[model samples]
Target chain A: MKIHENCEILSLYIDGRLDPSLKKEVDVHLLSCAECREITDRMKAAGKMLSSLEPLTAPPCLEKDVMDSLESRRSFSFIRMAPAAALFMLLVILVSYSLILPGKRNEKLTSGQNLLENEGTPPAVSGDGLPGAGSLKAPEGTSAKATTEEEERLVSGRNLMARIDNDDIKAELKDRPADRVPAASSAPALKVEEMKRCETEQGVREPEERVGMDAAGKKERPDTGASSTREKMGDMKVENRESEERMLPYISSPSKSKAALPEAEPALAGTKESGSPSPLVISNRKDFTMLWNLQNASGGLTCKLPDIDFNRQMVIAIPSNAGKTGYYIVDTVEKEDGIVVQYREMPIRDPAPTPYQIRVVNRKPGVELQKVE
Target chain B: MEKKALFEGIVREEKDKVFNLAYRLCGDFHQAHDITQETFMRAYGSFERFEGRSQLFTYLYRIACNVWKNSLRKKSFSSFTSYRLDDREIDPPAREPSPYESMRSEDRCRMVQKCLDSLPARERAIIVLRDIEGRTYEEIASILGCRLGTVKSRLARARKSLSEKVLPFMEVAGK
Candidate 1:
């Protein structure tokens, strides 16, 4: 290497970084070059002077200061996270509130549907109107204007009756079965005037009692003895009271009612009495499997078998009636001997054989069927 | 907690070497103190990134050099040019200087520091690490994040510049 190139190489040479061959080359070049030699000497002197300068001792408090700063920074970070933590909690609460509100609204809607289903008619025309009152012709001797007025009075009286509890009207009806006025008679004016009097005398009677009395009046119109009418009305009242009690628990607590609705649905669908045999109780999966296979072999069922835990529950399969299209479970009473399930039937326009009406109930040792007449 | 204890041990062990390196690089005791603190703070902040490929002191030395370089950039040229080291702020040596040798040694130290301060920051850092701090060429390369060849070339250039600035002082001391 030349003198100028050796200038850069001399730093490495002084630091002992050069190989023996290169170091020898730089040493050989240095002897012949005065300027490079002087440069190397000055560089060495500068390095020695720099090395002579003493290192400064750090302040005694530095470690303390650094740790304190780090500690403060850590605490400040936690404080900074406070708002985020609170925001997360707030988001959780809002999500839970939104989730719960929809469930309650759904329960209310289901309860409303159940009420409509059980009543079997639209809410506006349920109480004192005939089964198909909108299609019924006005009776003779009633002017169109008078018919409209009586209908209005009947509607008003129905509203008043709903406000009072059914228990009070049931008691009043029990005491005066002979004096009960028929609200579904051919004489529309007479029915309306009697309903108005009943409304004035004792608030109002339940529309169910009025409808029962009308059915009894129709059946016993030919007979002179009020005793027969009274017996029929008494049986009707007992059946109505039993049905009302069954429905009362559902209306009061919507959540449980929602769960129980599937079992109650088929029972609520019919109201007339049938002489069909008692329901077959299938308690275990083995019996259910056999029954299901038999049902499939016979032909498919009209409705799906309800899904239930066989350990906790059993299926009550009421036999299909050729004279009835649907079965309504009027009441289920658990006796020491067996469970007595009283049911009514819905008359079919065409009395064809129907599928077994299935009801899922808590597992009982034995069950008996009783027709509600 | 173990990591914190390890870091505290590092701070105790490496603080002086780092402070001395900063002191020679900037030629100001106060700025060196501040730079040393900043270096440790930055090291603690990014402690997780330290992969332990090198010694902890080498890593800390690299941070100190960076801290000094950044401080130089933030300062205006005029303020930097006008800046002077305050002798009162400098800590005394471990051993007391004799009355006779104190003035001459203090003057020589000041004059050498003044010459080091005149060089560019990169050159000054090279001279400080290799010459004053006595780090090997390979260590300087690792600390400065450069190739070994670059370290040699830069150190040559740095020593050359420092030699020119300190030549008059050396000549006067010789006389």
Candidate 2:
């Protein structure tokens, strides 16, 4: 801040060379000192004089001169830089698509084989035609993994998870057919009215009231052991593929009315009458439990149903087998009030996990899915 | 659609400021214009690297300063370009006409500029940018890649020296 120090910093001060702190000092000093003030004024005029000395313009041939110089050179063009980012994004998308989408051929083969092998009938769709042509929908049965190749593709896996749940019930029901026909498997040493009521509730025909009853009319014989149950199941004819496929559209649709629930009801009722306590028991070893939860404060669906329960449009699939897997879909809203269930138990293939994409459409109220106990 | 369109648009808009700054720093109309065109060409070549970090003007200013500085070097005009009258040449001609009334306004302006051309290249450059162009010290600092203090001090000395050379002429020109 002294005069000698101020003078050394002064020259730069006029030229904008002094730091702000030092410049502030000079500004304050120059305000009070006539000599330094005169010096500051003159320095400012000198700088201005130099700048206004010449007004410059680009020569007429400047662009031509530049272009002619540049004609022989290469690599400074604009197109070179833009393509890298675009190519990278495109590659990520193609890789994801390849990973996710499986061929139709494999899917059909899986469903076809499931029909041939899985013997357990699905949950009973009881209606007016008791045990007639009503088809069974096993919820949680997929045997597709025997042929599943590992990549990273996702199909409608939540539906597949629901089907797995139905299949578990089918496996349980198969081992204990009596569970399907509770009354016949139970003793019938009681009143006729009581027996008729039990039969009606179960959609079973009373053995005593039967006319034109052939094998369907045979009285229930209780079987305690697997061997005896096995004999009974062996004698019963397995429904052909055509019959199962023909009945699928009706039983699978959630929109079907309770009154018009597939006409195959009567025949299924007969199958139930003969089938014992869930002729199958789903063990925890082969038993895969799919726990699903999505982000909603008020309402959510847990796909732990006997069949694949697609009650809501946006569902999630957390296949323990396929860890952290999600399929992006703009789900169709529920067309009718009823729940839609599917039970295709031909070993369904677990989806490969390659093109697993999480495009978070961030909105004011974006839906979130997290793990729940 | 083509790359040239974007560059052309930039060139039309930014060429003047660039030319003026170059002219002020070099103190030669011919060299300043050349410097401006070369600055644009350099900018066009590296246009791909431009990621818009700062305003295009700031970038162009930095490029123009470098171009002017380099042209000074290429022409070996460093001694001439960087000379400060006090720091180097004081071509005093035995106390010229005492009235100081003989000089024209343009002669006074030229005399002041010729004296500024004597300062160090960077000091001369800073004076032209901050004092003459009335650029903010911060912008001058950024363009020259120096501290604000450097710009301030240099401008002060530059002004002081110019008036020493031209005040006699200014007093006359004003009368």
Candidate 3:
């Protein structure tokens, strides 16, 4: 074996790990090689020096320290989990708060929906045609007890509208002179004239002739009519026909003041010509909010109602077609003569009633309806 | 309670051997105490898994080797330099100056420990286990989790490295 190889094995040789034959070979090499002999002697001396180190005694406090650490670790496990518990509790509170907010919104929406459903009943209008004592006539097939409950809900809704209107009038009266303020008796008359202009611009046929034509058409195409009114008002203008189908005839409430009754006649006559209808013009925030909530609850096509300054802007709501489904306002074009509302009717799988379509317009005189195929 | 008592007895019996091994490996008295405590704590934690395949001290020596290796890694370079510096300040002086033989022995022990500390942790452990602790080659292999051939080769290299560091010191001391 080479001197280098012998040097490498020198440590193992001192530790007695080498075979007797290899040890004999190294022993023979060591006898002759001075470099290998010196290296082996030094390595043996180093081993002896390491072996002579005194064994150290362990400190007395070791066991106590370790036991204390283990005990503390066991006791504080709950403290380690505190953050996760806090985060879980926060998540639960957020979920419940989200759930409860929608529930309250749904309650307000439910009451508004009840008011809309009872629209078939004629409103007992006061002589001035403002929100009067609400007396609603139940539709056919509804029980009297259900009618009374519906009447009470409608009365509460009307009372809210009356309070809003009174507040608006008081604010208006404060801003204007007594002479410039329009008479309460002439308000319905102006509304009638506006309806007439709308009908003329839209080319709606007279209500009686359209009703006759609808009756004949229902006989020929039995499936075309989905309601009694649809069977009775075929090919009529949708706005006028649906208005007649859904709205109650405006009749004077049993009030002692007969002076304003005569002024409301022109409005009643216009209703007969155009078809019986509710007030389509929403002029206050309270009315718009109620309508907006009702629209959201009905789960139909939703419109983006612009933020309207009520003094300058109004919303004209086209009566919903209760007999047919899948009709929604596509857009509104404001023209010099009048505002033209364009609507689209798509075929739907389920034959559910269409929802009301409203347009935010400048508080102008007239609005015409147009259907887009 | 029985397991605790049994482990305490084991700690009592093995502490001196474990401490001596640690002292030779780290070349620091306080570090040896800490390493011994950590080894017994680890051994007690894993006592249920001991299975008694080899002797209990062999298992504990393996754990001590691992603990020492981990401490070497966790210690920063600056902290290691500081430990070397602190070694001079903390090492106890020989009590009896009149006894020249005892003083010479203590000086030789410090020189040998300083040379052992200069080697790599793995080589230092090998030298400490084989030369200082007097473990057999097979038992060293079991403690280090290496082959018998690897143990023999490593011990040879470790002893050679230790000789290189200690021989210069020995020459100075002789002069």
* Among all candidates shown, the one with the greatest DockQ: 1
Q: Give the root-mean-square deviation of each candidate in angstroms.
A: 18.7, 21.6, 17.4
lDDT of 2 by residue, B61-160 (tens): 9999998887767874443444222322432122334445324433654566566667778877877776666678788888889897677667656555
**In candidate 2, what are the lDDT values of residues A125-180, reduced to their tens digit?**
11321111111212222211211211112232211112222222222222221211
lDDT of each: 0.54, 0.41, 0.51
Docking quality tier of candidate 2?
A: acceptable
Question: Which sequence of candidate numbers ranks them by lDDT, best first?
Answer: 1, 3, 2
For candidate 2 chain A, the 10 contiguous residues with the lowest summed lDDT are A290-299
Q: How accurate is candidate 3 locally (lDDT)?
A: 0.51
Docking tier of model 1: it is medium
Candidate 2, position A137, lDDT: 19
TM-score of 3: 0.51
TM-score evaluated only on chain B, model 3: 0.84
Answer with 1 or 2, whichever has the higher TM-score.
Answer: 1
